[model samples]
Target chain A: MNNEKVWTAGLVVIGDEILSGRTADKNIAQIASWLQVQGIRLAEVRVVADDMDAIAGAVNALRTAYDYLFTTGGIGPTHDDITVDAIAAALGVDVVIHPQARAMLEDYYKDKPGGLNDARLRMARVPDGADLIPNAMSGAPGIRHGNIFLMAGVPAITAQMLHGLTGQLEGGAPLMVETVGCWTAESEVAEILREVEKAHEGCQIGSYPFFREGRTGANFVIRSTSRDVLESAVDTLCEALAETGRDFTPGGI
Target chain B: MNNEKVWTAGLVVIGDEILSGRTADKNIAQIASWLQVQGIRLAEVRVVADDMDAIAGAVNALRTAYDYLFTTGGIGPTHDDITVDAIAAALGVDVVIHPQARAMLEDYYKDKPGGLNDARLRMARVPDGADLIPNAMSGAPGIRHGNIFLMAGVPAITAQMLHGLTGQLEGGAPLMVETVGCWTAESEVAEILREVEKAHEGCQIGSYPFFREGRTGANFVIRSTSRDVLESAVDTLCEALAETGRDFTPGGI
Candidate 1:
């Protein structure tokens, strides 16, 4: 992953189903992975209900705080789906149907068996001035304005829209990661752990405690932009773990 | 579950492991379930890295915005576990060794070797004026300061602490949920759907379209605090779906 660019992204998962735990959101992970490949880091993720005030507050806060903000859900062709109006309210703009969006829908359903009607036409309503994001899975396109990208909430469609959208973004350098797995408690490796952190000042070293089948251990992942820096930090970590007579194995990039 | 209490809760899931996709945090789901059982709605959830600034910002924001805030992670003995200090910083107070917390640890390790040392005692440090929430699984108790409850990130230990802490909270009236599952497209059910919504003024309804096992349909979940209102809404929804020759099953409490 590239880490050279200074791009940071945040996710606003808009849906009451998600907050109620009735639906498990997959868009956050999908977007985070796409951003990683594009060298953008996903710094924060927030889940809010479909309430207008909550949606507006999250959209405004995240759009201004991060370099890119991606929202999924509430952009469907039903009355309960109010993402467009809520987003317009967040931007303090009047919601209006865009002509280009309507034309796109007209062209999309011109040959389809299920003809487009007023209900289907609801998908064409977009906040004023937002650019359309082509949805490869389905015809109804996503909309983007400023730093916020509004996409469908369905996992497959969201992934397709994100795949097409990433190409349009300028990515930072991908982050490099190296890990050493060992069956030692984190506290046992504390002394040399501090030294490793101090030596790799440019990298982030994290110790994650894990337990499986009654066994307890940790996986230490060292991350940095520079390969040499990450490798050197892993070497130090391995040596430290070795001194404790602990079993350690190197993991992939 | 009572909704009359009018209290809201938020969750803060700490740890870079989750943001990097190395681990899927379970604390949010656990806390959400616990809060739901108590009739306290979980208003929002934030997943952030282990950085002090991120943790502090989330803690401060959630504590102020919601009636209660619960945080999970960064409470281990390792150097990377800095949640105690971060919570203290969020409260703009100094971290102090609470006598009750120290006593709990003392009792926990009284007969064990390598008992509470200076390093291990670090777990006993908490924000000033905070009360301890006993951990049934492990002796390292969680700390509660007014509305904010700080607990361990481990699933088992977090569950234990939350169970001990729930009884102290004032619960809102239980949220009532009703669902109608039907094999109808969103566009096909648009007109009567709006009528059902307009007729039910107090409840909120959500339409979720899903394509599972080669079938296409949607599920509408109607939620409210009053059972009578929810039942009437569900009845109206059923009648509307009946007009379209669609079937629905009642779901949820």
Candidate 2:
């Protein structure tokens, strides 16, 4: 394996609705997938409430822990949308309305009803020294303060913001993955999986077991920064499974 | 509002697949909803990979931070399933095969082909002095080590385990909720939501906005420990929406 730098990012999903189970969070997976393609590993995720302290605490903790910190939710114009304010507090900065964002919102709402009222104009507010992450889906742009990104809670808007951010950040070698599925109990091959993972350098395997159709089975995912190592590990695991008289699928179940 | 002791819980989701974006997490919502019914608030959630240190760190942090701590994933029979070991390390305890869990698994797998093999028996392992939380859906029971719980990752299995645990925990008065939906932009009523929540001493209001069918709308949820306060807050919000000449739905849109 090459001694390449690994970039890591931390995500903080800010929403009380998520904690209340009123909203099943889509941002975690969306951001994780997006970061993976950017060659950045999503090292950790924290789901916090809409409260200002909670949001600020998570942002501060994650921003210092990872190369990048992405916060989703609470960027809206409502009272509960306190992410920008919280993040500002975390950065020891003052919140101010950005001229560019204000102009964008004015243009977007000029022909529409309600026409940029106080609540709608609240979207223009950002941290004092922050820049904007373009939002293709809506007029409200995302805030980019230092390495921290403040995004929309709406999945569609978050997607647009991420799309606009693609290829903008620096990344390292992307992790490659291979999956092998077997129609047998994972316990039946615990020793083999452990030994194979131990033998492989820079490669880790994860076993996900499932019970379906009155039968037990598992899918093993092999991941590594090097494709050759990942493939070699997968081959060894496949051989071991075959030797045990277990039928295995290459691409998983 | 009556002064009652509030119970809070934290969840640590341990899985590489979740962080890899290969799996969309259902356990967070499931556990959150279950905890709500049990009157325990899900205070925070952390999603970490399958690494032992990550799991142990999250477990130790959350277990100490909240009244109760629950973990999902990495508790199966595979080598990668190290939640039991991780939690044991976090609690400074030795790993032991619980005799009761072993007997239960033996009885459960007697008619199955595997028939309680060494790998399958691994499911019986728990931290020394830990008790079993019954699993009605599968053979492997959940682990209850003091105030910490280790549950399965699969949503179906987690649901069954939670069902087995319902009404078993001590909690405060359940937070009552009332939702008001309006086919108007949330920003348009931001002040109203803030003022209503502030006027109600014991209540909190969350505004969730959406854009659908070429129209912007929002759902406002009012939550409080006292039913009277919750109802009063909802009434005030509804009246404000009416005074603004906006049509609102009582339940949600």
Candidate 3:
């Protein structure tokens, strides 16, 4: 078992569209998956509206609780874009325009209409003592203040931000995952799943049940830092499902 | 402006799958939309792992901050389904098997291959002093302890649970919404958005920018509790966009 200190990150998703159900959130999954690849666990996520108090409260709580904290949304060029200001308040620092960010925006928006106006210049604002996370997809760059990363609400731009940050942070061994599917009710095989997880130290299994085509099925997801332990758990789960006369498949259905 | 009380809710999403990015959650949006229809505001949301302390901490924090609290995931028959125990710990209640829940499960699984075994019976367990939220999709009914709702993680099952409880919780006026789209950069209309929002007194306008078909566009979403205020804000926003000579569309692009 790997006894290394686990690095964890928390995410704050700021948007009224998401809270109002107008936009389905994609950043949680995107960042969570990206964090797994970075060997840092996505510890917690808080989705708040575009209110300064709400954003600052969540930012302060999460940034202190986890090793890294990331926020998405409210970073655009409109009046509703207050993520930078709110984050600056949370960090107890003043918002300032980074020279590099201003230069990048000036160059990127040079040929475009409404070139670098006050509204567009809002993109250059960041918390004091922060660096920029380049957004190859858009002109506006993401802001990184210490361990806090403020990203765009748009999934594609956030992807670019994650790309800019790939493998930049220190991390432990990347967690490995393996999934097995069974054409039986999870309740019928709950004991099998528990026993397998208990037998393997430092491994956890998750059971997701689904109803499709008038039948109930479940996918047992096995995860561990060690590939050997994860694979062994999957094999044990499959054998148990086979012995119980339930058809099973590896890598999920 | 409607000065009446604003009903609010907080959600706790519990799952390692969500944190691991294996599952993009649907419950937050579903519950948020449902709360809107019920005239309650979805104030904040926290997504935590399957750990006991994590679940309890979020459950306790959210259950107090809002008029109501909802939790999704870990209410199954698997070893990882510790939501019941965690909620009980948070509420300082004992875990007890509800007679009605057990009866419902027994009848539901009577003719099945495994008829209400110990693992399957786990569904009947609930915190003492809690009531069951009927799950029309599955036999395992959701547990409701006062204002804290413990729902299934599965989207469809949670939908059924919501359907069963609709029109039951007391809420204020249902929030109204109007959306306008423009085939222009939001930065070009940022002043229009801010001015309109300020004039409306109670309405909020959110600008969502997107890049599509090699051009940038934006959708301005106006939300308010008063129908007249919302419509007036929308009309003013459309007029402003029209004056700018930007092609604008009602109901979004």
Candidate 4:
């Protein structure tokens, strides 16, 4: 099954705006997709408020539980930006202004108004003994402490930080996925799905049901580390659906 | 500060699709917004996979930490729809087919093609001694085991379940919000934000920065339980912004 070598990561989304429903979170999906491309499974996610205690607690728990931990939000240049401080507290380290980050901020803002003031300088702070993750989209760079990555809350900036980190992480085999769509209700083929999945040793199937255009249907997504196993599972599932006289589509509806 | 009566709820988003980044989660925003209207703060969130142990662990942890715990996903009519069973395991209760749920399913599916088959009947299973949260969008009712609610993963179905349970939960004072947008960089007014927030009792200010139209701006959201306090804080922030000679907008940019 090759489950022994699977790499997992956990994400901590730090913000009150998300928990308050004021901002719809885009980082979860963005980071999850990014982790998949890295062959790292995103095992869990915790969205906490801006409170120092909350952020520290989540960071401590997630960082220990997974191979990698990623956090987004509360890294801006305002009073509410406390992610660096909270993460430092979690790691039991001192918060220090990185020389490279300070240099970058200085060069970027020297021509702008309010040139590298105290508030702007806050963006250069990082946990002690941490390296910088280049932010090509903004002047403030992302922070990386050991296996934990601290990123921006803004989706675009986070994307740039993630792009900077591409191919830098060690990962196991990437998961292969195959999809099959059935026009019939999933309940009618629940037993078939289970039996097909059981027959495949290394594959898992997820059924996502949807009601659209006055009809109900579902897409079965089969994922496995082995592409051959995933393909075999899909073939069995399609054969079972055909045996049940249910009309099915190959990819999805 | 009216903190004594503040109500809280935790959400456990149960879906592999969400963790896999195949589907962007809508339940967190929907449930968070709904809880806010009910005057209950959405305190924390955990997005877990479809595995039984993962779901049960999150359910137990969240249900104990907050006044209410809501789970979305894995409550459909398929083999992967194992939320009812997982909740039962978490609660140390036996999984039983509720008579009322079964009757509802029969009535709903009588005119449909699959007339309440075994796979379809899986939706009627619930943790022992639990009640049902009506689902107007689908036949499968949401499960309510004490303060733990198991809802459908589909956004529309989850919304329907949430709608059915609205106004049924007890909560404290709803938070009131007032926002002021400033054309200046948030770093330039970081001191102002910190000072204004410190002056206002029971009020918090959050700065959200954005870059648009070749200019950097930020929206400051002031929140408090008391409307008078919120308005006063807004007035102080606006006055401070004016004092800085920065052009400001009333609502947001």
Best by DockQ: 3
State the lDDT at B132 in candidate 3: 93
- Candidate 2, residues A1-253, lDDT tens digits: the string is 5788889999999998999988999989999989988999999999998888888888898899899999999888888888988888989999999999999999988987779999888899998999999997779999999999989999999999999999999999888888999998787788899999999998989888888898888899999988888888999999999998889999999
Q: Which DockQ-derived CAPRI band holds candidate 1?
A: medium
The lDDT for every candidate, in the order shown, is: 0.80, 0.91, 0.93, 0.92
Give the candidate number with the greatest TM-score: 3
- DockQ: which is higher, 1 or 4? 4
- TM of chain B, each: 0.90, 0.98, 0.99, 0.97
**Docking model 2 quality class:** medium
Tens-digit lDDT string for candidate 4 (A72-164): 999989989999999999999999999999999999899988899999999999999999999987789999999999999999999999999
Alpha-carbon runs more than 4 Å astray in model 4: none
Q: Clashes in model 4: which pairs?
A: none
Give model 3's TM-score versus the native structure: 0.99
lDDT of 1 by residue, A125-231 (tens): 77777888888666788889888899898989888788777667887667778888887656557656768988886788888777667776778888887788888
lDDT for A108 (candidate 4): 89
lDDT of 4 by residue, B1-253 (tens): 5656889999999988999999999999999999988999999999999889998998899999999999999988888888898989999999999999999999999998879999999999999999999987778999998998888899999899999999999998888877799888888899999999999888889999888998888899998989888988999888988987888999888
| Selected candidate, larger lDDT, 1 vs 3 | 3
Tens-place lDDT digits, model 2, residues B1-253: 5678889999999998999898899999999988888888999999998888999999998999899999999888877888999999998999999999999999988987768888889999999999998997778999999999999998889888998888899987787888999998787788899899999987889988888998888889899988888888988988889998889999989
Between candidates 2 and 4, name the one with more favorable TM-score.
4
